[model samples]
Target: MKLQDHSASLSEVNQSVDTTVVHKSGWRKILAFFGPAYLVSVGYMDPGNWATDLAGGSKYGYTLLWVLLMSNLMALLLQSLSARLGIVRGRDLAQANRETYPAPVNFVLYILAEIAIAATDLAEVLGMAIGIQLLTGLPLMWGVGLTVLDTFLLLLLQRYGIRKMEAFIITLVAIVGISFFVELVLARPPMGEVVTGFIPSLPDDTALYIAIGIIGATVMPHNLYLHSALVQTRKIKKTNEGIRHALKINFLDTTIALNLAFFVNAAILILAATVFYKAGHTEIADLHEAHRMLEPLLGTRLAPILFAVALIAAGQSSTVTGTLAGQIVMEGYLRLRINPWLRRLITRLVAIIPALIVIWVSGEEKIGQLLVFSQVLLSLQLGFAVIPLIHFVSDKHTMGAFAIKPIVKAGAWLISTVLVYLNIRMVWSEASEFISGNNPWWIDGLIILVGLAFISLLVITIIYPWLSRYRMERSARMHPTKVTLGSLEAPSYKRIAMALDFSQNDEKIIANALAQGRPDTEYILIHIVESASARYFGKEADDFETRKDQEQLDTYLALLAGRNINAKGVLGYRHRAKEIVRIVKAHDADLLVLGGHGHKGIKDWIYGETVNYVRHYVHIPVLVVQ
Candidate 1:
């Protein structure tokens, strides 16, 4: 017993030590990690950050540059943890947290994540309107009306590849970079103040809040989720050398993007200090103000033009990353495979409608303030999300070979504590000031309920670490859903509808499943050319099959089988594997016998669908008959 305990303790200690060296830090090869790093960087350059950065600089000038500098470095360090988690542990934060966390913790993370995405969408809409106003000389209202075009463009872009969309994003970043650079040079006031801006300090009701906003805007919670998952897409070899190279390139890409962001962030502040503060403009309450203000001083009518174009670029780029990140978060954590376009539409619609409503009721200035208010709420959401990321990444089990060092962990905790404190204090101050100054009893109720709920959640989040083992054991005790082959008794399922596309041996395998019959099992031999189904039917063929194809499919399967037959040849463009799962589950089949003839070319199997979508949605015992 003593020896076993000692061994267990040593094993745990070994595990703890291993995570430090987990990333296997090397850099001779950095090309592999570029794609995901670029995608992740979009979040850094998102329009929300621009809203805050622009506001920060215009409101407080170079004073808040420190925050931008600090936060970018912070984001770089934290985001690197995400990349290491994927490369070393072979799981993104979502997948890792799903396994490492309890039900309650996982649920909290998911809810916060979804909320963050929604909040970010709010700014993207504003950015879009700003862009339209820049390009076409339309009102914010009309500009917003036109942003639906962005969604259509996004959908069309997807037909090519995610990389093409990424390229477009780089173009946006470049435009943003150049625009900011020109503004910085044009507004050049004092080289000394700009240099001093890099040094951190607390500067009154001015840049301080805006600086925090810049920090908040940059290290978005969703991008962390997005980055972790995106790394797997590159198909990097699991070897240490390959993994190190991937990390190096990822660091390079992220560093480049974020460093650019730092400059732009600084530029915004420097320009604001030089142009707005020196000019004695007390208010820069909206995007229009900033634009109009620039026109008079820059001595160019193109000032508003540059402003709107930058806003549009920032808006569109962020929207893509937001959609992709949301997709990653949902799909990774909840196993919910939502369509990207539809998902993007939902977020876009949600963002657009509220802006339209606000514009219809109030005006551009009010709407823009509302966007800031939404961002404040986002600050709260982001506060909660950061805690878990910090907690999980610092854990030995989760980190495997890349756990944070003690100094780093301490610093992270300190930053997190201050963030939470600021958020709570701000919330209380806002609720009290708003409620006492002008609001009613419902505000009281809302404050009480929300505060209590947050407290309850915090308590649960704290206590969860202790209860996890017990809860895990309890979960383990529950019986799994009964999934058995040869259980569904049917006389007519011998008619096989084979989901056939990428499987050449599909016929051979279907024949084998027919020949190697489970006496009690009902067999639905299905050859589903889903693409063909869609082509011929001109609509989705859900076991909603055409009679001729069904009859012909039934006859073909009936020719090979020895039992009851009810086969259908359905055509649809749905994923073939998922289609099979849905069909088998809907019919309550005893067995889903897929034909894995394995006769396809290597390239075909690699590029095409072999296991179908089984890895994503299948829960039953799949019989891939040879």
Candidate 2:
């Protein structure tokens, strides 16, 4: 198959051609592969991580810094694998899952991925609002409301292209890194104790809970999906040598970006350990409380200001990635595309409504707890994404020589097993606590019911890949003979309808329609007048532009007459696609031919998507002439 026949990863912004044409070596070549991991890395040190790192640091006094280190390493490996899958197989994690699993299974997986994204966005909404409130003294509710406007900001950025968007994300990341670097300087954390904190130890169940949250916040599930799709944004050569080169360069990108993210996260925990724990205030879990204490404890007003600025930067950057992941999951699993703004609005609403209610019911004090819980919820969804990714990249038939080695496959499974065990343990601990408390009996029953459902889904995710592989192997053995195709029938059209915009494409559309028609076929020439007067008056309007449109249709009719073709002209006003569809049905045409304008991105917005609307609503075989 030709390359263009294959489906594009992100059709709107798929600019691999640009990268393919620009042949650069050395550092310039490496720079082309750098932006994707930076976008993926923002999810690591988002506002969600701030809540978990702060809780871990203030309560256990840096005992859980080891969790941060471990999670970062895992993230590095998994993200590299994700990039390899996209580069080798030309499929994202979600698309790979869709191709491998049954329809019902893919639907469930898509929902889970979306839930993880919403959970991530929930933390971002709260974190950004809190930061806004801290820095500008705006009400938290007002700040939450203002975040809805960010949808437009994202839309504006998208118009500029992905590289520009990546540049914007990198700038935010720089703001966050620089802010934390200054804060670590001001707090002056003890180097000796900080080094010892790297030794692994979980103090209690609470520490375990925070540690799980830390893992979830650091090694995000959505980032896996995002990274796979993001890597495809570059146009690399399809040869094995080219794939190997891309993989090597991408590993360097992932390592550098994630380590910077690690620094931002570790700095948060270390600063919290020094400023909050060493001062005898161990329960400084709330971000608001932490910010309030920063000035007096560190004896510098600049400390809290920098804290708020970094918080805002992290939230904004992470939210952009979260929405982008949502887009990838929906398109990959369902093969459906909607307006980007609509998707953003739906995701923001899902996160915002819950946040608004939580604040309204329990007040802002619960924001820290909510953020931590969201991260843990994200952790719970990790296995669904990670398992499928491992299965795809490890498949020898699919990945060929690019398949992961046995040792690497074993390492991936080990990580998966550790994540699964931790998640189970955390659920059990939380369930035990809830049941032992004075909570209602139904609440306990509900918890058990949800736990059973979650286990069933996870088990299906784990075993489906192996089961699928076994079934394929068995079928191959049964059908040993090579299959051959039979001849097919050709279709002939009796009545053909051609829609014209009175542009140069009208000739191409008419010629294609003639090629599909029989000698006795009748032709219906259609056009829609989009002038203002015709829109109001419809068929009765005798305006100058409408008359010229009618004249154009007559001109086409005269041309068809020279060939002794059965032809008639029909003109309608108002909505273009709607009128064309109506006229085509009225004429009972077997095939409809329309010209393609090739509009995309912001142009699709400006010039309404007429071709898409007509093709979808019309039942006839529609031919698009380019």
Candidate 3:
């Protein structure tokens, strides 16, 4: 089996682009490797990071700048490992885990990965909403509702192609960088204090808590999944020399992009330290309050405007990448593919629902706390992703000649150990406070039960490699079934069923089906007029839609006629999947052929389940050509 053939589809964006440096040299060669790191960098300066930076700077002045610096260094190291894993192994982190671990272990890791993505999305959603609330006088809940529209933005940009989308993301990152640069200049932070802030120090428990949040938000788990896949989008030769060149260029890309992210994060903390901490307004932790106070503190309108603009840009860029990460995780771990738009909607809604509830019930007062807690949740899930990445990239069996050197391996392990320790300490502190504080007995019991379960799962994950090895050995000894030559010599397909949505992809579907068609084989083309949309309008509207659908089907039939293929078009109203299955059964189709657009995220949940349903209901061999 070819492992490269099973690479996640998310990396197919720019797969055709040649990243080899045949004639190119210096900066020009480096430019080809620029995109993936910027995409990863978006997570570093997202709203969750913003909330922590603001809280740290305001409450403790520039004391926590060392944490930001430390976190960025860790991010730089981890992100490099992630990219190397993809480039060397031709597999994303999630896919690697799925292939390496046992079913039960993989399932637990999948759950943790999804939770990390959701937590990351929650921060983005809240940040965008708060940015909107700052620029306009809208309520927090309304602003959150508006964020759903970003799904449409992603859909629009994606249609233009991956290069275009990368350019757009780069522009957003530029906006954020320039916005913070201007703010940094306006704030004019003390050079002496800023330099001193770089020295490591933690004043108290609050500082430690916020410091952990910074690390969690900065070294995002999804970015590890995302970067690994994103690196594969560029075409690199599989030779040892080509791999080394690519790794070097990628290291440069990671360093440059993450330093830029560091500047943005540092500027946020410095701005807070200068304006709020110096003025004795150290309690300005809320995003809205930070935005509102900026104008008065700087005594200029551009200060606040720039602040809000940067905030929105950060949030928007992160959410776009966040959506892609969600799709990669789902496809990588579950081997389940859905429409990209639907996948985006599902993940966005998952994040948005919780945010909307918090806004409506607890109000914006709780948002700051919620953002911090979300990062902490991300911190909890970080080990599951990071540990596996380190293990794979360092393993000679997996990486071959490209496996990490001993020095690099030692540093990576050290970073992972520090992160794991921080996360455990944060959880322990939170649990201690919860148990000590006044609360209901049931609530305390619930906390204890949840903590126990988490510990149990952690233990299982630790021992999973041994379990996987045992299972592999046991399975290796089992006998396999064999097929006879007569069965292999049967006819390819007697009858085939094709489903069409009458979209631009319909022709592609028809072309693919024709490729499989024989003179004796029959083909049934299907179109379903959805009942819900028909009911939204009246019978006249439904009739009009049916007429349009029929016209499109006729064009398909005409194409089939020209090819001299035995084919007929079938139309039905109301249910799509059931109708397609019924037509397939009625025609006695030996094979079902359909066009898969690979719609995912939010769109998958809403209307992209048709193919899934057909696959489950139909007993025949199904050929889904994407």
Number of the predicted model whose lDDT against the real structure is largest: 2
lDDT of 1 by residue, 58-167 (tens): 66667677787788887787787677665665555665556656767788878887888888888888877876776778888887767666666665555445556667
Could you estimate the TM-score for every candidate? 0.74, 0.87, 0.83
Global Cα lDDT for candidate 1: 0.65
lDDT of 3 by residue, 407-499 (tens): 999998898889888887878888988899999999999998988877776666556654544232222112346645565654578888889
Q: Any idea how many clashes model 3 has?
A: 18
Q: Which candidate model has the greater lDDT, 2 or 3?
A: 2
Candidate 1, which segments miss by more than 4 Å at Cα? 1-29, 155-162, 239-245, 438-442, 466-493, 498-626
lDDT, candidate 3, residue 78? 96
How many steric clashes between backbone atoms does each model show?
21, 0, 18
The lDDT of each candidate is 0.65, 0.88, 0.85
Displacement of the residue 258 alpha carbon in candidate 1, Å? 1.2
Cα lDDT tens digits, model 2, 1-626, are 01122255676676453444455776777787789999999999999999999999999898888999999999998999999988887778877887778778888899999999999999999999999999999999999998888887788788778998999999999999999999998988889999988999988888988999999999999999999989989888788888898899889999999999999999999998999999888887799999999999999999999999999999999888988898888877777767678888889999999999999999989999999999999999998888888988999988999999999999999999999999999999878888898988899899999999889888888888888763332221134457766576678788999988888888898899999998999999888898999999999999999889888888888888988999999998898889999999988999999988988666877898888789878888989988
By summed lDDT, which 10 consecutive residues of candidate 1 come out lowest? 1-10
